[model samples]
Each structure stands twice: as structure tokens, then as C-alpha cells.
Target: MIRAYRNHPYHGRSPLPQTVVAGWLGITQAQLSRVENGPPLVHLDRLTHWATLLKIPESQLWFSLPSRTPTNRTQQIAVDLLAGAPQGIGLSGGSPTTLKATAHEGGGTTDRRQFTALAALAGFGGNSLFDALMLADRKAEVVGMEHVRLASSLVERFRQADAALGADELCDVAMGVHTRLSTWAARSQYSPGLGEALQSALADLANQVAWLAIDGERRQQARPYLNDAITRARIADDPREEVRALACLSLLVREDHPSESLHCAEAALRASRGWATARLRTLLRLRTAHAYAQLNDVGGFDREMTKARHEFDHGPHEDDLPFLQFVTAQELTGIQGLSYLALGRPARAAESFRAISSGPRAGHRRNQVYYTVRLAEAEYRCGDIHSAAQTGLRALPEVRAISSGRTMRHFAQVKSRLDRERSASAREFVDAHGRAFQR
Candidate 1:
């Protein structure tokens, strides 16, 4: 495939240089050569990324890409709702398309592009009809397992979208979904089982919304959302949702309230004792490790980090929760690197950050940008000023594209540090992209 791309007719009579493909793949030229001459790539995410990057037809690929198809009845309903269903066919006897038109009829108008983006962010594409169904004046009806399933899917998609696109249209869309689900679970009639399920889905949605708020640097807003998630999770008797929310709470409060963060992490671990998958345990352990790092407990941090890495490597089985998809080995390494930096172990941190390869860059745009900035920080702290500048440069384009305040804040910190250096490369790179680092 690489060879074919290199030899495409657009390159004129000769093949495009390996250096060009290497730059495109963000790998070294030798690495590209080895990949071209090496054994076939087997990793699913890696292959999917390459296929998407190269615009390969799905029919030609050996493995399936990240599927956009609605997987169940609930998903189909959700997709239809987002895509603006035909007039007068929905539960409220109103058309989603009509609702969108009506909403635009008044002097107020929404950005059509944002609507398209929200739909696509939630793993569908087209204008959204969610406004009609989610309006405050809309009558609430009894929700069943299917409604709960739809909410669950929306939460999962919101997480996935945040991973790929960061939190622009995502946070607002997720909040809308949360409001609708909360209304259904609170005021609408349902069987006890359905009610519990709805509450659980709402818990997950609230957690997702809190995460988006955190990503957007709205930490104050995140606290109440996460607290609400915990309450809802407990009401639903769902350990998974409770633990997930608790983990987010741990991260959110780790810096100012390390002890509280530690408490949250421990509580989450305890909640997951019997039922958690290896991935879930790994995440909880990482949260515990982060708390330990914050509190300067080197021994506790090291112990938990060891356990987290071991468990993360052991399994990501079919039983793992859908949200655990982001808990990759690459992300684990990045977190460890960041924690190492927090502990003043920049040399070790640089080593861990350097270990993250380009294989996971496709679907993880936000993480890649964020981790690259951290890697730059580690290098800067280790006194490799030029290397740090170059690493920071690599993240610049992506930083512009993503909407992560947290990542941008860290980037600004590292850039400020790099700017103080006398090195020519550091000064030039810092000055060149100074506008991006501006608040």
C-alpha cells in the first residue's frame, strides 16, 4: 500500500520519495523504509489509521475501520433523531427536520456548521434534530431500556468524539443529552428496572459532560457534574459508573486536594473490587498513582504505577467497558511520563514520553498533541533545550486544530520555559508560534 501510494500517477513518472511518506507518517525515513520492507502491520488501530489516512476503501482493507453504523435499535433511533427524521414520525408526533426548521424560524439561529459538527461528533453526520426532542417544553414520556441504551451509546460516542476532536460542539451536545436523560429518569414514568438503567446511563452522561468541561478547562463546572454523576450512579446501584465518576473526580482535585483525590481513588478501587475489568483496575490504579504523585508519596506512587502498568498490559478483554477504549498502553505511558514530571524525575519522564510511538496517532489526535507537549516539557527540564523546541514544534499544528484548554495551558507553560532558554532553536521556535501560546 505504501509503495502504491508512493508510485501514484500524481507523482508524475517516478515514485514519491520515501522521505516524503516518512514525513507524512511522522516517522523517520529509515522507519518508513523498514515499514515498506518489513512484515505486514498487524495492529488493528494502526491499520485502521493508515487506511483512513490514505483514504483506502474499506472493501480493500483486511480489517474493518471504526464503524459508524448504528449497532442496535436504540442507536438507529438516536441516529435518526440526530439526522433530522422525516416530518411527524417521532415519539412526540413531531418531525426532527420540522423542529430544526421551527427553531430557526424565530430571529434566533444556530450555526448550521455546529449542528453538522455535533452530529458528526456523536458518530453520525448531518444536521441535528435533537432540539425538538430535547426542548424544555416537550412532554416527558415513559422511557424504556431502549431509551436507556440510546443514552448509553451517546455517552460512549461523546467520549470517543472527545478523543478524536476534543470538546467544542461536544460539551454542549452532551449536556443537552444529559438534560433530556435526566428529565426522563426524574419526571417520566418507567418500570423500576428501566428507571435504574436510565439513571445509570444518566450517570455516564454526567460523567462525560464533566470530562468535557475538564478538557475545556471549566474545572469549577466539572465538580458539580461529577458529584451528580456519583449520586446518580449510587441511585442506580452501578459500581462501574460510580467508579468512573470517582476516578474523574480524583484527577480533577488531585492538585489542590491531594488527600481528597487519594480518597476518591481508593473509594473507586474499592467499588470495583469484584467486577472491574483489568482495564478498569488499571485506570483506578493510575488515578491512585496520580494522587500519590501529587502528595509526594514516592513509594505509594511507584507501587501503584507498577501495578497499573502490569494490569494494563495483561488484558483489554471483550468484557471491558466501552469507555475503556481510551485506556491504551500509549496513554498509560503518557500518564506515567506526566506523573514522573510532577515528581521532578524529568530524565525518567523523557524516557517514558519518548517511548510513545506514532502507531496510535490516527484516532488520538488530542492525546498526541497533549503528550507531545509534555514530552517537550520533560526534555526542556532535562536541559535538552533544542530537542524540547523541536518536540514542541511538532505539536504546534495539532494544537491549533484541537480545542483543549488543559493541553494548551500545559503547552503554554512548556513554551514559556523554552522561551527563557538562550538556545537559538528554542528562541526561534518560540517566537515563530508565539501567537498560538497567547492566552
Candidate 2:
């Protein structure tokens, strides 16, 4: 057991690098390696910190207890609950290390499965990336008015991809478009309309890149791109892009800075009040609802969600921004369900999840896994342990295929709940899923 921790496969998948994890543990990386590599003389306090950082189960850790514990397990529950686990940001993992357009030949290509996944994602993404890359390689004469159409199409495609794929699969491709747009803007001397159009394209792509960063679970790292998006949005004076940038900032800060989240949501609403299209307004209301949920303001959450649903159902989306078209009544339902989770209304949350999908679409694999695990959480919260575990177990195969910090967090949360459960079936379910996640 002591030897197992040295080369634990768990650290390989962790978004936090060893240096960052060691910092959180208040030790040097070399010290951490030494402590983790050698005998089981690491202190109880350090073990507690590791459990909290990695979200390990107390029961599982105690089964191979180190000999260094002083006495009784008085601190056992403290280690188990970890009610206030530190929310350290993960370094962006699985993304291209830089914004450079990666060459497909030589050693740049990833695994076959990753290529397949990227292909599937790009299919739903309308091959805009492929088209953009092709145009990017040609002279400026080859990039005419159609580049604008392709840029707009890219936004819509990414909106679909956002709902379907996990963020890791989305990040690098988004950055590629972002870089292309930047290069064109810097070198080409276009007319006023063309330049504004180019800036709009750049802003939207930057927003997508930043939003994907948030979705990929690297919110802190998203700040630079997000700021660039906001600035370009103001330059282009595009309300839709501004709304997205605001909502993303709101989403990013809702956990750590709820007040700021509310402010950002309000800023989104204010920016879009008269100039924005109806679908854009609905998106803003949803952002506001999300912030309200984070603050536990039930009335505010319900009100904004109701408005979001009503506006989405009745409003004309024909004139909406292409990317804004993704905000459907069905997607809003999922947001409402998530708000219920924040409000501690598991029954309502489960009901909402049930409405999002009666059946899964073939290409929307990641969405299926995410919603299934969410439903499992609601079931567990309502004390239906058997159904909860069974439902979650069904998604393990899909979950294994993708990597998302948000998805991993949900798994960790469910694991914590199952660990505290007294039911033998629940424990068994935890064990099965536990090994699956370790892979």
C-alpha cells in the first residue's frame, strides 16, 4: 500500500501538476517526491491534505493506514468530509502548449482515438476549422467575403460542439482559428467594413477560446483571452459577443466570487438591453439565473429561469447571432436543472434532467454522460442509492472516453457521497466506478 502511492496512475490524469500540488501541500516538489516515494512515514496532517487535494475516500485510505498516525482516528471525519476542499485551479491539460497552428505530419499527430474524436467533433463543427485552415494557407486573394461566412459558420459549429464534446477536444482547434484571425487582422489592410467584420470574427473566436478554457477547467488561465475578447467586442461594438464575454466571466467567478458573478451578469443584461436580439436576452437571463443559484437566491433564480424559458420559446432566433442559436428551450431546461442542484432541490433537479433527454443522440456522447451522471447525483441526493449508482455506472464507458474537469468534479462529488453511504450496494457501486475513474 505504501509503495502504491509512489507511482499512482491517479496523478497522471490530475490536471494539477506535481509542483502545484506540492505547493498546496506546503512542501517542495523534491520533498513531495521523497515523501511519496519512500516509506509510510508521511504525517497524518499531510495525508489529510493529500486526501482533500485528490478527493480520496477516508475508508479506502484507512484500509492501508500508515504506521505514523499518533493514536485514535479522531480526525477521521474531518478527513472524510473535506467539506471545504480547496478549489485550486488546474493547469490547462491536453491543450496545445501554445497557440501555434500544429503540423499534422511528423510527431504532431495524437493517438488514433483522439484523431477520431476530433473528427467527430469537427463533423458537428461543420468542418469550418478545416476550411479555415485551408484558406489560412492560401494567399489573401483566396480569402474574400467567404472568409466572413466561414468565420460565422465556425461560431455556430463551435456552439454545437460545446454541447456535444468535452472542452479538451475543443481547445486546440479553437485556438487555431483564433491565431489565424489574428494573423489576418495584423497583416491584411482591409476596408472599414472588412476590418470591423474581421474584428468581430476575432472577438467571437477569442470568446470561444476563453469559454473553452473555462469549460476545460482552467478558468484562471482564461483571463487573458477573455480580456482580449471583451476589448475587441467593444471595438467592434457587437452586443452579442459582449454578452457572451460577460456571461462567461460570470460563470467563471460564480463559485469564488458570487457578487462579481452577479455584477457581470448584470453587465451582460445592461449591454444587451435594447440592441440585443431576443435569443441573446434569454442567454443573459440564464446567466443571471446561474449567478442567483450560486448565491442561493431561489426566488431570483426561479424568476430569471422562467423569463429565460419564456423568451427562448417565444422569441425569434432568425436574426440571432449564429452561435447564439444554440440556446434552445431544451438547453435552458438543463440550466434550470443545474440551478435546482444549487438550490438543494434534488427532486426538481432530477425532473429537469429527465426532460433534457428521453433518448441520447448518437453524436452527443459527452452530453449523455454528463446528464446521466447529473441524474445519478439527484437520485443519490433523494436517497435512491441503488438507482443512482446503477445509472451512474451506465455512463462510465462514455466518461472514460473524454476528459473534462467539470465531469471529473461531478464524479468526485458522487464518490464522496457514496463513501458516506451505509448501503452495501452503494459501496459496491463506488468500488466499480472508482477503478474505472482511476484508469
Return the top candidate by lDDT. 1
lDDT of 1 at 24: 80
lDDT tens digits by residue: candidate 1, 8-78: 99989999999988888776686577558643332233344556766778888543455454334444445
Which 10-residue span in candidate 1 carries the lowest summed lDDT? 95-104
Candidate 2 residue-wise lDDT, 1-439, digit = tens: 4335434687564445557657876667765564554333222233444665555666765423333331222122112111111212223444322333444343424433353466565583243233222222334533333444445545556666666767766665555556655665667666664555556666777788787777777666676567777777777766566678888888778888888988998998887675566787888899899889989999999899888877877777334555565576656777888888888999999888877656445344555667777988998998899878777777667677776667767877887888888787788778888788675
lDDT of each: 0.71, 0.64
Candidate 2 residue spans exceeding 4 A from truth: 1-107, 111-117, 124-150, 357-365, 420-422
Clashing pairs in 2: none
- Model 1: residues with Cα > 4 Å off, grouped in runs: 1-112, 126-137, 357-362, 435-439
**TM-score of predicted model 1?**
0.72
